[model samples]
Target: MLRVKVAKEIREKEQLGDELKTLRSKVKELEKSLSGLKDEHARLAENEEKFRTLIENSTDLKYRCDLKGRISYLSKAWEDALGYKSTEMIGSKFSDFQSPESIKFDADEFLKELIDKKISSYEAAYISKSGNIIHLRFNVMLYRSHTGSERGIMGTAYDITGLKCIEDQLKQSQKMEAVGRLAGGIAHDFNNLLTAIIGYSEMLMMNNLLPENAFQSADEINKAAHRAAALTQQLLAYSRKQVSRPRAFNLNKLVNNLDMLLRRVIGENIEFFTVLEIDVGLVIADPGQIEHVIMNLAANARDSMPNGGALTFETRNVNLDEEDCEKYPEVTPGPYVRLTVKDTGHGMDKETARHIMDPIFSIMDPIFSIKEGGRRTGLGLATAYGIVKQNNGQLRVTSEVHQGTAIEIYLPRAEEKIEKKETPQRKLETEGGNETVLVVEDESAVRIMVGTLLKGFGYSVIEAKDGNEALEFCRQNKEMMIHLLITDIIMPDVSGFDLVKRVIKTHPGTKVLYISGYSEEEISNKGTLGKKVPFLKKPFTPTVLARKVRGVLDRD
Candidate 1:
């Protein structure tokens, strides 16, 4: 019995040993799992800290809000940018900081899109604590709680006000450039028509056989034609087409001559003052255009102050070096004539000044819209701008609302004296000798008038409707001596240049005189007309026509 009991006790001890071994294995596995969980928890904590650091320091105004638009949390950037403490902003409604004008009724529509389509971004204006408007681009997403319950909205707000201003300025500039081009083209065509009417009317008035009434009628026609001509000249000046025969002329002389006129134009209310600097040499510019520029600027100043103010015209010589040129791209490193027109009148703000030079702004009269009884068109300044640019000059303006405005016009000085040649006196001779001249013009009335004038001038003038017709005439007259080819530059079918080439080939010694009202730039762009080719801009007086023809004939 003792032996049996010893064996049973040994078996029981073995069972106990097995149970202890199992417990030891279980403890080791639990310890391994516990160590792994600690490592994971440490990594998670590091990642959370990294995320927090990134959000806190970002320039973007990161924030979280509940579905009711109440701010739940905001990054440090939000508080710093908005001048709000974290405690003040945390429970406040996001809409509280928005202006009534800035409230988005579209938010409901956007919310529906957010929930249904997951649309994530929107833009709107926000009002700051200081009442300044701030444009914000909000990149937002719908947030949910861990249990998938709708939590709130989170977003990053980016400031876009500077970018918006740049875009607006770019658009305004593009619009102005487009309008200027259109104005130029219309002016070019109108000037051509004016030339013909004025030229013929002057010829009629010179006739001695006409009765008193006829002479009176002719005089009336002349006056009316002159008025029309002057109008077109202004348009051309604005379009940058008026011939800029720039010469070094004394600015003081120009201003002095117009002193009386300026006073009269501005009226008795505004006092006109001149601060002329002595020995201010001549600026290289078309004097008439300069006069117009002064007039336009003066008019603008006069209109600015209905109650009247002081208008000062100052002149001086400026030497612009390389550094000055860098600041003004339009200015070169050379001598310039500086004319400043300053007025003690209502000034303009930055937004108005930015668009002041635009033709449309001038056309619409937006600048003068706020005045009690202002009479003005924005065209005066725009026209001045066109004139300055055409003269290869620079214009600068400075102004503040209610403080007044100042305009500076800088015209480059002529490097050397431009020699002036007197118009030669015409020698009188009997009309109608046998000189065969080919007349090529596109306009029927102009062609007829020119033919009649040529016949009266004693040339055996042959008429052709266009350049092609003129070429055909030249071909037919190849065997005959064609003394002159007077052709219009712009025409249907063959251009004036093409006709000139064919005529030169057919009649090697044919003298070609090109006529057009188009500007030199326009003609040159069409084809090469060397300086030697005599060109008479259209609407020429009969005397001009006769003289040019005689000059070309004498040269041949």
Candidate 2:
């Protein structure tokens, strides 16, 4: 019995040892699995850190909005592009930052489509903390939870505000260019017609053969034509096509001289003052046009303050460089004189200020004056803009609702001495020239008027209806010693400049005189009329025509 018990105990001990060894092996396996898990956790943590760093530094705005349109996440770019704090914006809906119009048009329409489509791209406009518009291009998709259920909207946005600004500026420039072209075309035709009316009336008055009543009637026609001519000139001025008589003059002197006139313009209800820089540099612009600009600003200031306000004119000399060029791209980098016209009156909002300098905007705007007679012609700030532009200057306006308006006019400083122009007194019985003159005109009335006036001045005269006809006349009368070739600047067949080029090749002795209703860039390129070549402007009286013909013949 004792031997049997010992054998059984040994067998049991052997089984216990096997079980313990198996348990130890299982423990080893578990320890290896735990080590693998720890490695995976460390890798995952590293990946999360990288992702967070990328999202924080990315220029593209990253946002996640829940199904209820409440924002859950916002990237750091949101704060960079817009003047808003990321923490402040994280709980808010996109509509909170959007402009009212953008909310009404963009979010309402685009968000509806996005909801239906699940994945889409769109553009949205948001107002910045500083009240500037921020345009964004969003690429969004509906994200899902682990269970594949729709979770929230996640998107990336690119700031497109700069592109939007460039687009708007391009559109405004195109619009202004079209308007300028239309105004210039109208003035060109109107000036030609006025030349005929004024010329024929003067011829009738010059005859001295008509009755006293007939002469008075002719005088009335001449006066009416002159008034009409003035209207055309205003149109030209607005289009930057007017014949400018520019002179170098101190802007401060001009402001001082117009102090009383400006005060009268603003009336007693308004206080007038000038902060003149005593050493303001000289600017080369038409003095009359500059005067008109001053009075127009005063008038506009007066109109803005129907009851009472203050009108102030400030002048200063500024030296512009690359830094200023960035701000005023239209201005050249050089010395300039700045004229600031400020009015403490009801000011314009951004919308109104944007279109304030557009031609004829005053006719549509309610803030402009309708008085000052029809002579004002509803140009308002537009006239000043054109005058400034034609004189190689820029006009900038800044205004806020109820904050008053400030208009800054920047004109380049002139280095050359101002040449005083001799204002020739009108002589009804001017001297005649015996030299031959060729008159070319597309309009029969102007042609006939010119020919008659020249013939009566005791000069040999030949006329053509167009450039082609004049070219033919030059071809036929090669050895005629044509003496002078007077032609219109623009025609359908050949231009006046081209005609002169061809005529001068054959008739080298022929002097050339160009006539046009309005000045052109081409005129400036060739040295303005009466510079390199003698030029006669249209709408001249018989005496004026006679004097011009004599001057050309006498100049040798």
Candidate 3:
């Protein structure tokens, strides 16, 4: 019986040992799992830290909002962009910082984009702390819970202020091109008509057969036609299509010349002051057009202060650099002459000032004056804009409501020395020779008027209605000793340039005289030697025509 009891104790001890080994194995496995859990927790903590660092340092404006569009969290970029601390921005609605136009667009259009798309992007204008405009491009996505239920919205924004400025400038450029096309076409046609009217009126006034009253009527007609011609020139100037007679001239000299006229223009009630800087740099531009620019600005300044205020004109030399060019991409970096005109009168708003210089806006809104009871024409600013641009210059305006207005025009400095005005030339005979001349003009009235003038000047004249007729006459009368070929620069069938080339082959001895109503620039586009050859501009009086004919015939 003792032996059997010992065997049972041994078996029970073995079973107990087996159970202890199993518990030890399970404890070892649990310790390994705990070590793994610690490592995983450390890795996850490191990842979260990296994400936080990235979000904090990002230049993109990152933000989160609740369903009601309330501010939830914002990154550091918001402060740099808007001059506002994150604390001040927290819990505020995004619309609070937006411009009125942006807010209206978000409510009316952006919400629809969000509803139709999981991610929506939009360009918005936000108001800065200083009331300046900041343009931003927002790329937004719907923030959702793990279960796919919508919780809020989150987005990133990029600064697009500079890009927006370039876009606005491009739009302004396109509008100016359109305006140029429209205005240039009208002016070109009107110039042709004016040439005939003025030429005929001058001839009538010179006629010895008319009564004194008839002479008065002819004088009046000539004056009216000249006025009409001036109007056409203004249209061309504003469209930058006018042929500019650019010469290096002193800006200070021009200011002195305009002093008396400006005094009368500003009236007795207004105070006018001249602050001309001696030895101001010379500028290259059409002096007449620059005068127009000054007159337009001065007139507007006078009208702005109808109740009598101070008007000041300041002239100085400025050296513009890359930094200046950066602010104004339309201008080149170089020496410039700055003409500043200031008025103590009501100013314009930002919106109005932005579009005020646009030619299209000026045309559409003729009565759009800047101040109360102002009679200034809408073309005032636009005319200045075109003239400055044509001269490779810039125009800037700075003003605030209730404050005064300041306009600064920058014209490029000329490298050439200022040339003195021409003295009277040696008088040439106003009689034509017995040489045969061909007059080519499309307009019958203008052609007839030119023919009569040449005939009276003692030249044998042959009138051709068009370029084809002119060329055909030259071909048929190949042996005819054509002493002079007077042809229009721009023609429908054949250009005056082509006619000259072909006629020279047959009549090499013929002296060529090109005439046109088109501006020098336009004529150059049509023919190669528009400005290079002996040219006579249209709207010439009988005396001028007579001198031109004799001068061309006598030239070796």
Candidate 4:
């Protein structure tokens, strides 16, 4: 019995030992779990600090709003963007500062969907303290409590007003460019028809044998044709299709030369004043077109001053910079000639000013006494605007009702010195030469007219309707001396360029004169006529034809 009792006691002690070991193992596990919990708390605190720093220092506007649409938190960027302190905007509803057109999303509707959604992005505009619209793009996310219950909306807003303005300006410029291209296409064909009409009318008026009444009627027809020609030239200038003959000339000198004419045109009732800069920079442009622009602006000013008012013509040199480029986005940073035409007369209202800039808008008042005919096409300012743009310049107008009007024009300054162009010697004799000439043209009327003109000049004229006929004529007349070859630039079967090459091979000594209604830039290889080759634009008067023929024939 004693031995059995001893064995029972030993088993009980073993069981107690096992229980103590289990208790110690549990204590070690508890200590380790406590340590891990403390570390996790420290990590969470550090993450919260980093998030707070990001929100405070970020350039993007950070905000938090309650379900009632009241701002509970606002970033420092509020003051930076909208000129309102964070404290002042903290409790204010976002709708208070938002523009009427800026509410792109419904907050209540978006919040209702947030239980299943996490993130969204949208754009809105806010009215600043300065009364300017501020555009913003916001990236928002739903905020929630640690227990996963919804708290509110938190988002970052990025300022995008500058980008939006630039985008709008670019879109407008592209639209204008598209319209310009369409206008150019129409003008090119229309000008060709005008050239023929003007040429024929001038030829008829040159006849001296007509009766006095007939002469007067022909004179009227000639004058009407010239006006039509002027209209076409204006269209070509606006479309940038007209061939530019750019030369450096002083703006002050140009203004001086037009002073007498301007005074006469503006009338004695209007007082004219000049405030030209003494040493204004030179501008490179077609002198004729520049004069046209000046006259148009002056005429506009005269129209404004119906009764009697002062018209001031001013000029100065300017250096445009980055800020100027922003205002005139199409202009580059460089030196420019600044011209201002100011009139103290009946000024235009904002609406009238805006409409007048369009080429189609014209004011019709028969009793205005503005123009000689008292009928304005309303294209004067439009033409001036177009010419400036074609020359890589800028035109800006400002006006206020009963205050006055000012028109400012800026043209890029030319770097090169002005060089005198050589003029052809005058042929005092009103007679023709005895030189043999060949004319090739596709148009029957043009061909006949040219042949008659040359024959009347006492030249032995050879005519060909097409290139094939011209080439055959050359084959048959290989022995004949053809002193000059006047051909159209473009023709059927063979181009003028090809005809010239073939004719030159046979008649190596023959001079060539290329005539075309198309711009030299359009048909030439590098926007230049061939070296040593004479060129005459179509719609030439008899006098111009005689001078060009003599000039080419006399050249060594």
Cα lDDT computed for each candidate against the true fold: 0.78, 0.81, 0.83, 0.78
TM-score of every model versus the real structure: 0.70, 0.80, 0.85, 0.73
Q: In model 3, where do residues sit more than 4 Å from their true spots?
A: 1-59, 83-89, 103-119, 146-149, 366-378, 416-429
- Give the worst 10-residue stretch by lDDT in candidate 1: 369-378
1-556: candidate 2 lDDT, tens digit per residue: 8999999999999999999899999988889888888998998999999999999999889999887667999998888788899788888888788877774334445556776895487787999988888899888888888999878889899998877765766666567668877888888888789889999999899886799999999999999999887777666777787778888888888899988878877899999988999767789888898888888778888777777989889999888898776555567799999999998888988878877876657666555636434334357787778878889888889998887899999988989655455589565448877788889889888999989888887889999998788888878878888898888888777878888889899789888778887665536654344465777776666777777767767665
Per-model RMSD to reference? 7.1, 4.6, 4.1, 7.2
lDDT of 4 by residue, 1-556 (tens): 8999999999999999999999899999989998998999999999989988887787879889987668999877778899988887888888788898776456677677665565477777899988778998877777889999878888888999877867755664565456555655555455445545655665666777767787787678767766766766776666555677777888898899999999998899999999999878789778788898888888878777778899999999999999887867788999999999999978887656654545434324332223555556435665677788878888888898888899999998988776456478656444579999998987777777778877877999999998999999998888999999988877778988889889988878989898876666566742347656788876566667777887788778
Global Cα lDDT for candidate 4 = 0.78
TM-score of candidate 4 against the unseen true structure: 0.73
Candidate 1 clashing pairs, residues 3+ apart or interchain: 195-539, 362-378, 432-458
Model 1 agreement with the true structure over 324-411: per-residue lDDT tens digits: 7765654679888899999999999865786787676667775553334655443667778878888999888889899899999988
Between candidates 1 and 4, the TM-score winner: 4
Off by over 4 Å in 1: 1-105, 114-162, 240-261, 274-288, 314-340, 346-361, 364-378, 391-404, 408-434
lDDT of 1 at 80: 61
How many steric overlaps are in each model, in order?
3, 0, 0, 0
What stretches of model 4 exceed 4 Å from their correct place?
A: 1-176, 267-271, 304-310, 344-374, 378-380, 398-405, 414-430, 465-469, 475-477, 491-493, 525-528
